[model samples]
Target: MHWSDRYVGQDYVADEADCAVLACSVAREVLGLDIQLPGERRPGPFGRGALIQQHQADFARRVDEPADAQPVLLIARGRAQHIGVMCRLVGEWWVLHADEGAGSVLRQRLREMARQGYQVEGYYQWL
Candidate 1:
């Protein structure tokens, strides 16, 4: 069974069950690495990016290619505010993430989400 199956369709709650939380949970469970994030977004425009950078420094290793269980950071409307766990299915990378608009956890093609206006910033594996 996919590790992300349990997270699929989970209701998204700000500062609770959102993308950051879900991504961290997935990493810890699947990679056995604990990456921490704040429940509430920090103030200012770079809040999310700052948090991600901190986590990366703490335990994440930036990788050039996506794998079965890597975390991907996404940018929407030019803001670094979303993160997800990626799984390779049929040779395609799919992201497992939750959002308010989707209202739940969903798996979507990386390209699909990119077409939806999310720019994939980077992929990382927790160390």
Candidate 2:
């Protein structure tokens, strides 16, 4: 089945599941790859959890297309640790992600994950 079908009614948080889910959906749609599981649960390449590393790699290797074609970089964060998609670029200070709180995707501030103290592990993607 398609990823969209699997995502129906799937709830998420701003910096947690919502970001991860959005990143997964975008990766699948744009990259045609899958990154759901890993050898073992470990921190992401650039972060402290599996999901962040997975999403970052997927975006860099695949989704970092042309400016006009570049898809959003979905991410997972926070205590609840959810995921969301990066929908668009807003100027130079912010990137957009799907916000479950609003029941729709929206753009928000863009901060370096390192500065924010977030980590990554493995991730799933489409490309």
lDDT of each: 0.78, 0.41
lDDT at 114, model 1: 74
Best by TM-score: 1
Which has the greatest lDDT? 1
User: lDDT at 106 for candidate 2?
Assistant: 46
TM-scores, all models, native as reference: 0.84, 0.35
- Give the CA lDDT, 0 to 100, for residue 60 in model 1: 67
What is the per-residue lDDT of model 2 for residues 1-127, given as tens digits with 9 covering 90 to 100? 3323333344555444554446555566655656453323333333434454444454444433323213343434543243433322444433334555556544444455434443322122334
List residue ranges in candidate 2 displaced over 4 A.
1-17, 37-80, 85-93, 109-127
